[model samples]
Target chain A: SQQGEEDPQALSIQEGENATMNCSYKTSINNLQWYRQNSGRGLVHLILIRSNEREKHSGRLRVTLDTSKKSSSLLITASRAADTASYFCAVGTSYGKLTFGQGTILTVHP
Target chain B: GAGVSQSPSNKVTEKGKDVELRCDPISGHTALYWYRQSLGQGLEFLIYFQGNSAPDKSGLPSDRFSAERTGGSVSTLTIQRTQQEDSAVYLCASSQGFGGAEKLFFGSGTQLSVL
Candidate 1:
């Protein structure tokens, strides 16, 4: 069973606009990481937020984790057409396994 | 190699036949993972191998699916008696550490088509 579930199965936005994606998990996690897949080929690691951390930032990507709510969010500022892809949230447990969510398909119009 | 590598980028096999997919992880990485994704769907964890430790096979959908990591570097995923339902993209990933918090490097994946 998938541990995480992402909201907004699909989103369409214009370049230069900000895009936000949400993910909710069922059980406690040691950390949560986000990944992006392009052309259904390979996935690229985006950002990771440990259980003890509340927020993290990398370039235009900002990630937030709320352990109490068992949820996380990813925000992409000033999106570009190249930012279009499928974003997945993966929950990392103590067992050394990562469970991914259904993912959100983001389409940025140039 | 500079990154994870997978072979046979595309495969088309007849039902009931067996197929093997290979993954060569980044040098020195100790952890490897296999995942499957159907069209327009999220990835489904298939198996995991860390060092010499026994691989975690809990996520494998059935007895027909199996994987092995040799020399702690190259890995192979085999599916026996393939069925149409088994058609999907098989992805491989590797990490530098045993913990889930470690970031993973992925391969381009093998697109399996069970006819």
Candidate 2:
């Protein structure tokens, strides 16, 4: 069973627009992380929001965690063509391993 | 410092043959992980190691799949009698420590195809 599941399998937007993706999980998590993957490549770590943190930000990426709902959201501000990629959310447990979601594909038009 | 590195960027093998994939983690990292991603799909957890000890082998699919880390640095994943369904990209990652919310460094991954 997958611990995390992202909504909206794909998203497309124009340049300068903001893109948002949501992830929901089943069990308790120590942290939730977002990752970006270019086509046929390894994933790049984006932002990690700890269980105790309600929100966090890095550059244009903002993450919010809602432990009460077991959900998280990733918002990319000013989307760019370079931001076109697959975004995945992973849940990290106290045990130290992470379980990833199916991912949401985001395409930013140049 | 170099990031995690994986070997044989690409591999194509016969269905009945055995294949080996190797990973060299960043120096000083204590945790290593393996994952598989199929075309148009998300990553599936395979195995994880914490300084040569795997407290979790539950992610491994079957007896035909196995992995080992040596000297707490390099690790290898082996698949025996591969099947066509085994075709996918194998990714490796490493982190500075175990557990919590530390960011992980990843390798480009090996594209494996079992014909």
Cα lDDT tens digits for candidate 1, B2-99 = 99999999999999999999999999999999999999999999999989999999999999999999889899999999999999999999999875
Q: lDDT (CA) for every model shown?
A: 0.94, 0.91
Docking class of 1: high
Q: How far does residue B85 in candidate 2 sit from its true spot (Å)?
A: 0.3
Per-residue lDDT for A52 in model 1? 98
State the lDDT of candidate 2 residue by residue for A10-70, as single tens digits: 9999999999999999898989999999986799999889999999999999999999999
Q: List the residue pairs that clash in candidate 1.
A: none
- For model 2 the local lDDT of residue A63 reads 96
RMSD of 1: 0.9
Model 2: per-residue lDDT, tens digit, B16-92?
A: 99999999999999988899999999989988787756547778888999998888889999999999999999999
User: In model 1, where do residues sit more than 4 Å from their true spots?
Assistant: none
Lowest summed lDDT across 10 adjacent residues in model 1 chain A is found at A1-10
Q: Is the docking of candidate 2 incorrect, acceptable, medium or high quality?
A: medium
Cα deviation of B35, candidate 1, in Å: 0.2
